[model samples]
Target chain A: MTNKHNPAALNTGRRPLRGAGINLFYLPAILILIVFTVWPLLSGIQLSFTNWDGYSPTKAFVGLSNYLTMFKDHNFGTVLVNTLIYGVGSTAIQQVIGLGLALLLNSRIKGRNIMRAIIYLPALVSAVIMGTMYYFVFQYQQGALNTLMVSLGLPRVVWFDKPAVSVAIIVIINSLQYVGTSMIIYLAGLQGMDHSVIEAADLDGAHGWKKFRNITLPLLMPAFSTSVVLNLIGGLKLFDVIQVLTGGGPGYSTNSVSTYIGLTYFSNQNAGYASAMGVVLFVIIAIATTLLNKGLDRLGWES
Target chain B: MTSAIRHAEAASRSTDTTGKGNGKGGRRIGHALAYLFLGAMIVAQLLPFWLALSAASKPSTDMSSTLVPRLHDIAWDNFTTAITQGGILTAVGNSVIVTVCSTVLVCICGAAAAYPLARRKTRGNKLVSAGIMSLMMVPPLSILVPLYTLMVNTGGVNTRWGIVLVTVAGNLPLAIFLYTAFIKAVPESIDEAGMIDGASRFMIFIRLILPLLKPVTATVVIMTSVGVWNEYALSNYLISDPGKQLIAPRVASFFAMQSSNLGVGAASALIAALPIVIVYLFLQRYFIAGIAAGAEK
Candidate 1:
């Protein structure tokens, strides 16, 4: 309601027809979005109801059949469960580890900058490289891990043979690789905290665990929420690591929805069915993200 | 002001009493434990890179050895063979073209679009912002099939430009969101001053605004480049020609061709990763800042 002049806004008195010209700036962007994003999204929804092999022109419209087929598929069920576990587990691990690292690095440490750089190296590397590196590390015979285990007088475990363990390892590797980003976020939050409040707590004998729990943790909720949402979204959409490391294999144990969709669309050449799966995945993500955003709002994150 | 004085007093008191009793011993033990944990974590993180570097340097025959490679048997030929026989050079070139072009285009278009959204208080601003936000939530696979079909129909499939354009499009929402956030942080006063000096809007953006946005620009460039270079899924489906494939798809195909050449494959993979690793090492601060900004928003 304040009538303060905003220089960015056009002067209506001098430029009465500015609105029409101003609207022109939006055309190129809107056109690109429609062509590249919105149209494809709408087309994908349409394709979900049809029975179209990727190549053939002839198609049959099948309502909800593809969705029904996905429901009945055992692999789909397993993959859904896997995606949830991976999402929750990775988010938890990454947040905790990243928070700890951020706190440690926040304090005075020797060569902190160098350590920060080294820790962040993995995130910058392509998922393919990270997966390949892990593949060698988890190789059955000549793996570095097996060698280390042998030296430590522990049994050489075949990582990929067991489904759950293989999936967990993949999640751990991916989470660790990305922890640096979360750590940086937490570091920023820490930097922005009111230092005076922390000092007051210190004066009241809030030291160590008490100080951390009462002062540090509560103030760091924004970072926690952000990290949690990001890690969850990332975990659900995980593809590159799984693709390179196991190819959704050791018998589809590590398969995610993204990988499944890729296999169905590209390898199986069932575009319509894949589109249906994609829609389902999209709905799930949208719902989860909405819930999270609501929760964050309640926690005053938007402020 | 009182808090600062209190903090100083507390620090002095703590230091004055630091040499008391068995607390020093306890603190030393705690420090040792912290160092021990940190060292182990560092080793865990660095071990893979160490292994890759050592293995790449070792002769092919020595690759299967249980022991770590000796410094003497470093097979420098692996680098040459990786480029020549492994066909990594062409893949590297393809990756460079795709990453560089996509990143530049995304940055330009994203910034241009973001300027209006960030600066103007128009009727559709909120709607536009929400639309872009929702676009970020849409899973990549949801539109993959349709996009592929569209590309094939439009004669965009199997071309470098095709890959670049798609990557740019896919990345637009996030890029615009980040750019809007960054541009908002720059005050409108600068624009007013430029206008008072009789500068055009485009001139103001290019001269005043763009220079100040170097940090965000570096962050976006690094992120987008790494993403484009390492992307396997899009390249796998789009580029059928092996010669035109980027580094990731090339690695996948190379591994498929000769599983026994794990050493060479690993080496080639390392070679592909080196540029990003180098960039990350130099611009790590900006990378972290960009991520922190994105997450915070």
Candidate 2:
């Protein structure tokens, strides 16, 4: 029945279904994107220059005042720094731990499948819930840590008393929750590797650490980039965990730009300033993503 | 492949023959250390959930360490209270509606969008594709203020369809990227065959391409469902009404209100996490594969 369709045999040839009409298939998606994402993004930029208090209909054009105010705002500086720390700290830690776990599980370990499942479990759970669960370890009253301290006849230590300590806890929790993502990525990369190359290197007296550094490490570059970028973006946009754990408390000391924006808009009612901060966050992520991609591409080329 | 394995086995055998005596003790110590490290990591990873379980089972008056489990006096009321007072079931229902609606829209729109982009490489289509892909990098919070305003003006705030549209838009970029990649791999000859059969482009897409999209659709569905189900940033503000709020925001708010009642808080958190955990356990293979595929984009 299929052979009966020989219309193309008489003609020179028919190209692979090329037409302007088919482009309409993307219309629905493009319309949704335009309305929901692109339009909002553009309007956010426009709102950055206004002095709207998020509720009032009337607004005055404030020019670059919002952007200028952001520069002088000491709290914004702290939030920006925290954002970077969360992004870089989590990315670095996740790579080390994720790769280590992946390597360990890849080896001939007992019950590795279960281990993999367990390690990856939290990555699937909502970060808000994970943060609440982890709060048990650091909660002030009857916390796991405080309970142990009292049992050992020590003073009750406040876990989130200081800003730095709180920030560090957030980083660790975020990293631990999502390290499974990186581990799975690297595991896939390792499994898909050209084992023949490893075998050849092995035949040439390359063993263990030497083999891993020269052969395996370079081969895992693609996975490294994917995991790093994903983790980095996730960390930079860290919201739920911080919201649940501290709610950007301690006088905004632990706020990332994300949490700061929410506070500014909802709590502070500084919609214009929050919009400016949103623009800044977007620009920062854009620059970071571009620079990291370029750097990774160079590394890939060199290796 | 067989020969590669044979060579790998032979290579290991040779390494064993040459370095057996010198490295035997060191290898044993290394294995032991590896196991120790992994065991400790396993504990660290499981500690939170274990403690949550313990806390949920204990009474609110039990201010003992969450590390301690109540073997005899289990607080059954905590779970019931979370379900009844915490509005967890309502939140779960809200999440289900939003997640299902968003996932379906994403899969349909994404697959439809990818067909033309993958088939026709027109300059306009290429630019459109790039533009759509770039939206993936625009963090949702970055556009929250204006999006919230838009939702309010349009009466989309506190509505299930509103949240669904926003989530679908947020997730469609990645879904379209994945679907486009998958469809590009599918032989163009298939489309040509449909064309030769005098089938319309839509007919070819509906009849031929859609069936082959099953695997990628699974990846998209899993990704979008998990994302929308657990979404906090957008949904937190967009659906501020308690009845319409999704799981993450609802649970967070409930936990905050019940902060003193650790038992109820723990129960609510566990209830929110249970559905995803059960799904993951049952479809462990697909979850891992879906995430891996998502990351590849």
Candidate 3:
């Protein structure tokens, strides 16, 4: 055991036993993850099947009744559709705005850094805070947008009082805050672009649209996928802004799956119901994102 | 090989043509238009926050008359009112403790576990890395239903520590992912060099690795801390006590309770956001880099 002078012994000294001993470094993390992450997740599945109201001592196994009840519940269709719209609509529109801005901002514009900072500044504040501020701006009569609209001799419309309008406002507000995320990713991607591809396209008489479609967009698949995935996921799990902005109100019309679960658990005290809904949402997100990734995989043809 | 050579020649020729052709008449106009577009976007981004700040300082009676702030309308009472009315100070304390403690735990554990994964290339290591990465993909709140129930059953509800545990768990995957990426960049020779001197693996990690990890550690710390500070969902659900809640939930309730009074709500929003805004303004460059690293991963 005392191979004190041999360098090669250092490698073998740690081969079988001591080498595996180093895995103890992983124990704290693995432990914390197991307790906090793994257990909760497994129990999440188990708890969903139990008729526990988050507090009631009497817990009984209920099988798939919670899922079946949710399937029959009238709000399920509304909430599920609302979630898909939020996730898809926001992700789709943000890509265009973010990519467009990133492209323009990537140019040698005056105060580009300042502009980039401004673009990204909204991302710094909590969505709660942003929603709070916009609550002022989107107020029915005295709000900033309505005031500006009236000044321009346009009709002053109610923004939050209506269900459809509220959903649209939520989408717009969220898209504005996160567009910079897509922008930053795209800007980074554009910055790291292999210029030879664009140059090669130029030599083939490929102009702006052609070169962008063929070369730039194809090369940006990584960043595009990153932006799309993050935004879609963020949209799906949205709770904070929906909480502050509309409170998923006007009769649950604006309720995302997350907000619905929060409401069911906290307000309604239907914990088992909430857990079941959570599982369903988890499965939905998994399936949706997997399909999305698969769809994007094909468009990433050059890769 | 021949086609690649031919393409390289064509690329150089096109680079000259594109460079010279694009530098002329069309560039100036496009630049001006782009500036105009960017200016409008900046205003859109800033207007609400600006109005909120302006409204915060204005007397409530005069808040709706104009969107601009006036010196005569400056109301120092709003800040005082915000503190007293909303339990703002208590919420801020809760946020600081929760954010700071969780970030520290996450950084330590994430950085620690990342080392062996980075150094030892094994099938198990790869599986762990993939597990951690996929964990990042799952909306952490997808598991919140169970997590919240577990906390409640364990007498963890309404506690700062409960929120902290949730925060650490949520932040770990990203922290580990980022740290492992950064730790991989550190030469394995450093560990080898330390090992030759009879330093235990743990000692090498402590004496050699931790210091080398300061930059990424800073990145992880700032990201996780800021995130935990803004976290509303966990704090909203897990911590039921009003006094123990973080500023995010408090700010939300403050504005909601005061929704009828835009002036006060604006003021409370500003007060809630002030600390984070100041921090962002200071460490903005690092913040950008940290977020970028976070995104690319």
Candidate 4:
């Protein structure tokens, strides 16, 4: 089996038709992608400029009116602000906690694997389930938190009743569920580090926070970017937990782009407006991810 | 100097130049503190799930009065009511079907699309790869409005097959990206060796490549299936039928029931998540690998 052709044999000008089987391998996925993923993306842009209610067979073009209304809608304003806060806030919490866990776990520790798995447990449940479980935890009256607080002679507070607090709560819940992912990524990065360098640092008489600041974090930038992008995008698109927990309630203050888009499209009976909002949401995510990744790349290069 | 060495140097500078015994004792204390902090956090994290589980076991009426109803207050009726009254059985069945179908198809299609793109250096394939790459970056939400309308128009709404196709389509990019990276590591000699045996490319893919893809497949399968299983927005918006919908939305209806009885609702929610959680427990190694691999791209 090995004698006939070396790996060097395949790519030498005979690569154009590596095996006429290329189409067979590519077509099924490409076809499905075109129909489901590509088509809607193309059409969605066109739909956003119109006033097409979902039920209407014909979409009368409104030429940026939908976009205009989306920008001006006070509810949209709050949703946009909430989306930013959620994305930034959740990413911040997850990063700090995740990196701390990674650094701690990387050191010699007992029950490390168990701790990692336990932290990741919350992530296994769906957002709706987490939100529901937490609904019990945050109930103003008989809620777990309130019960504990009262038992400790502290004041009991309603968690989701206030719009701003609900927004903050949404970010906290997202961070709690997802921080494990960042930890795992960072741990992988830590494990991949060249240990010889650490030994050299030890020989150089350096240790502790100085070692981490000068060495570990920079090398882990790729993992850091991955974690940030994932958390940021996830935070931006947050829906299920916020939906279940607050339903964008105390008014639309807790709504991120996802839940707002759902509400607009389904209940508001305004597909065009929803499409416009979706497009805007898409733009925000695209721009933020690009900027964040680029900024990180530059930072790594500059350092 | 490499940041690695530089940081190492900085670390060495900060350490005490004192005797080894004192350093060892100090390190022990630091290690103990790290353990203590992590232990407390782990407990804090697990407490909510534990509380929910305990609540699920309790009688509905007792849940309201007790912060975490004791196991002694257990009511087997929570499961009975959840299964019987909550329509949990049907929702679970539907979720299983959708998640399985989508995951399998995504794996297959992702493999198919990834192989050529990853291997071929030709201009045409490069262009195609670039297209898929960019498309991968686009948010599925941006296309939600049109996707919903198309699904509706094509009679895809509320259908098992419809959601399956949608889920597969939505998740393909990540799968393809992962598979491509995985495959690139497979030396072309394996394929060339197979080709010398008169095995065609399709045969090589099936007979050779498929088996080798086991690790990435686990990653893809776990990630995609869990994603589809837990999905709420797509299933809810696309499948309006209460009975036909997946567990997320179906479980969502339990919120109303939860207002009255936390036990039954918690029981139902846990039941809905039980399958994925069980899968994660068994395949935790692959689950962690998958998260890392998926993110590395």
Candidate 5:
């Protein structure tokens, strides 16, 4: 396996025909990334330092003023808290529901295929569309839930009026819509599990809850990590759903950092401040992702 | 990322279930509980769509509860209004154009970039690979200020190519990662054999390596199209023109305008969702695979 002439080693290493000139193949992608991603990221940092209105030609250096303003902005604190809620809150719901569904459906049950398909279907639709459809349930007037409430002789409550309720609805919608993602990942984890290990546990009198707790759950750690990271990032970047459902409204009460950036830059014309929010968002996500990966690596027993 | 691809591949092949016996009474209770949970979830998952369908099929004058089905006299007019007044059809067209262009660009650029990193494996190429992969973590909205500024200054905003370029960049990292992993698994002998036949490196990549990338390319195409089609954060701002807006933003704006006409709003939302739903029904496996690959990012 260590020999250079072995095809496996050769395939992973620098091969004979794969010369330096071939590096040109990646130049276009690298260029696109540089111009579109890397450059904007750098410029975002630069823009954060100046008080430049988004469209204006002239600007003055603001030093740390934009970043400093965040400390004093009450709405900024709420938005930050909402962002964490969306991220951690959605991740929690998705994992619980997703794994529960995966555990139930990973069997010889009738309609399991259709169940899986239907469960995962929402993940395929645009979140904006999902959010709009979900509005039928939460609409103040003639909403489905309200109709149900009225039929039961209860009061029809306005769902999005309160900040807490609006935030919870956002989290629930996001989690339900993409919980299928985590479900499928866990299903795959279940499918890829070494059956022999499970059978051995069975032979050793491990069954049902005991088996799942001691064996199945631990075995699913890789999938758990993958799903958690994906869900967390997706939830943190919660934009489309919030945009459609609440529009981060009721006085910016439900704005994730992502949506708040939009509100500040577009509506408020605070591009410099928005750029600082963007920088904060980038740092938060980068740090969160790295920490999760590291922490999950330590937690995963199979590796 | 490779783990996702591997897991999906494994999932597609294995249908084995952990249905080993437990204590009889406990097992029966567990099964009952599972069934109860599954039924509840099914209803919960489908309820919104059901409500939307009911609303979409009714006229604004039909103030019936959304929980009830519009069994008879279903108003097709709502969907028609969605197309006519909501501009959903045009938005769909714009989404298609952007999605197709971005997906194709991502496939080409991703596969091409992957060849060197997977085959050549120079220190610089490895570094480049790591850097590109890292870009996947940068949420698009985080770069919104500068990216939008750059697009405006470059006259890139509101143009089809503008959205296309931005989406291609956004999607390229995952595409490249998927491609690189796939290409690495391809034996080096294939490229060596091409070289022995006097093919240039580019020729070998195109003539030999490219053909072998079909499976992974399917994954990339499926993932990129879904992503680019559903994209909102950047697309909403970069292409604010009504005619140029993608489906997500277009639907959001339409929903906003139709607040007084909830039926029309529901119709527009359903219309926007229809294409992806149809595609998902037909290609469920690929969508699952796309999730697996996308989950890695």
Candidate 6:
């Protein structure tokens, strides 16, 4: 296949005269990206240095005050901690559960396809819808969960009273909803694995736990890496779930960076502070992603 | 001791003969365990949807009960009340108009924009691809202030077009990435064939390329539609007029109503989610595949 499609053969036959035509097709995408994406990002950096309330026509420069205020703000610190806990905690759970499900489904099992479809249903539902649905499930009174506990002679629990627990519930719900996506990716990776290695391990008296740990797990690192990065980025930017489930309440326990920025800008009318928070979030995400990419590259998993 | 020795000898014999019987037995157990675990997971995942559907069907008073509704009672009434009293119909209309217009425009623009990036080999292609990739990492909050300013300056505030454009801008990066990936799969031979036949680039795109993009286009359409329909932040900020809000914002407003009409609120939530859910159920396979594709490099 490589010999038949040699670049030299193509180049000898046809000089590249289609550059103008190609540029015509490419220009719009570049234009749109600059106008909408690149411009906003630069403006966000500029805004972070100003004292512009969202409604103000003219803005005064505040230098580094917004950044200093963010560091000093107690609520911002709490939200930062909350974001880390939610991101790491949810990513870990989803990775474990999703990989387990993928391995289970990859085996020769009846109804595997149907089970895959069923498990994936949640990913298709809107985050807002899921939040609304879970809200009723966790409500103090008239909630199905509380009713079930009472009927079973167990004490009723207030799911939202404790901020930490409510945030945990939000993380769990979001993680579960997205597990199917990572599971499928893992399944694809598992399917692409060479079976002869497992057979050889079996011949060497390795079975079950030994085979998985020594062979299968190491081979599935690419999928693991992909799932982790995707989940981490997603968890960092979570908004709709919190908005729907708890509305950043029982007093800001479940507020994430995304929601904090939203409220700061829209509700508090502090655009400059919000932009500072946004810039901070962007820098953190960029550093995290860069480290992850470098780590993956060192492991030679890019392919 | 004699019986144990006999059993050991029998196991050795079975192993020496390829262990087909043992393998079958072990596989059966594994299958059963897999099914059990998957069944439990599926049930847990579907519980919220079941609860939502049941609550939507029951009257507000009955919804608070522990028992599940045996049959849907307030179906038509809830829907009608949600539309009239809750003003969900207007929201739905706004959502549809915005979603449809934006989706069509994005499809056209995204495909056109992605074509060169997919086919051409140039130094700029790498930069373009990286730029699009990095765009995905930007949190919506990063641009909320500037985008809001842009909308206001352009007279887009409080208009359907404002929300629509925002949605388009937000979704375009991902759509272009997906389209480019799929477009690469279209054989260069087809393009050569079209060019040899003296077809103009425009004709080639419309006649040759567009038809071949059905699957990816379907994926993009369904994804963007669901996204636009369920969008809240942009609509919340941009559409302040009660008459101009979309489904999600309407649901929010219904929840915040001073009267506290839980029945109508629940009904509105149900209505907002039903279209996406039904579409999803029908296109589960494509939706799953599309998500997986989007996640892939």
Q: What lDDT does model 2 reach?
A: 0.90
Q: List, residue by residue over B1-297, the lDDT tens digit for candidate 6.
A: 533433343334335434234476887897788678777898878777777666666665563642374383555566678788778878878888999998997788889877887888577786877788788788777787887888788898889777877787778888888889888899988876765555567777788888999888887887787678778766777787888988887777676571244455567777877787777778877877776666665
**Which portion of correct inter-chain contacts appears in model 6?**
0.43
Candidates sorted by DockQ, best first: 4, 2, 3, 5, 1, 6
- How high is the TM-score of chain A in each model? 0.91, 0.95, 0.93, 0.92, 0.93, 0.91
Please, what are the lDDT tens digits per residue for candidate 3 over residues A1-303?
A: 568656688677674223867777778887888788878777778878977777777888999988888879888778888888888889998899899899988888778887888788888788999889877677765678878998899998778778888888888889998888889989989988877666766667656654676567777898998899889988888888898998888889899888998888777877788888888877877777788778878878534
Residue B182's lDDT in candidate 6: 89
Error of 6 at B259 (Å): 9.1
Per-residue lDDT of model 5, residues B1-297, tens digit only: 533533443343233444455568987887788899999889888988999998887788888788886888888898999999889999999999999999999999999999989988778888999999889999989999999988988999999999999999999999999999989899988888775555678789889999888888989989899999899889999988898899999999988998878889999999999999999889988778767765654
Residues A14-62, model 1: lDDT tens digits: 3312233434445666667788778988898899999999889898999
Which 10-residue span in candidate 6 chain B carries the lowest summed lDDT? B2-11
Writing each residue's lDDT as its tens digit, candidate 2 over A12-77 gives: 344446767888999999999999999999999999999989999898999999999988999999
How many angstroms is residue A109 displaced in model 6 relative to the true structure, after the best TM-score fit? 3.5
Regions of model 2 farther than 4 Å from truth: A1-16, B1-25
DockQ of each: 0.40, 0.54, 0.49, 0.54, 0.44, 0.30
lDDT of 2 at B256: 94
Q: Which should have the higher DockQ, number 3 or number 4? A: 4
Off by over 4 Å in 3: A16-18, A196-207, B1-33, B63-66
Please write out the lDDT profile of model 3 over residues B146-199, one tens digit for every residue: 887678778888887888888888889989989899988998878878887778
Interface RMSD, all models, one decimal each? Answer: 4.6, 3.1, 2.7, 3.0, 5.8, 6.8
Docking quality class, candidate 3:
acceptable
Question: Scored by Cα lDDT, where does model 4 land?
Answer: 0.81
Cα lDDT tens digits for candidate 4, A1-303: 453355455455344336455756888888988998888877888888888888877879999999888767999988999989998999999999899899988777778887888888777678888888777778776678888898899998978778877887788888989889999999999988888777777777655765577677777988898899889988888888887888888878788877888888888888888888888887888789899989999988764
Instruction: Name the runs in model 5 displaced over 4 angstroms.
Output: A1-18, B1-24, B293-297
Docking class of 5: acceptable
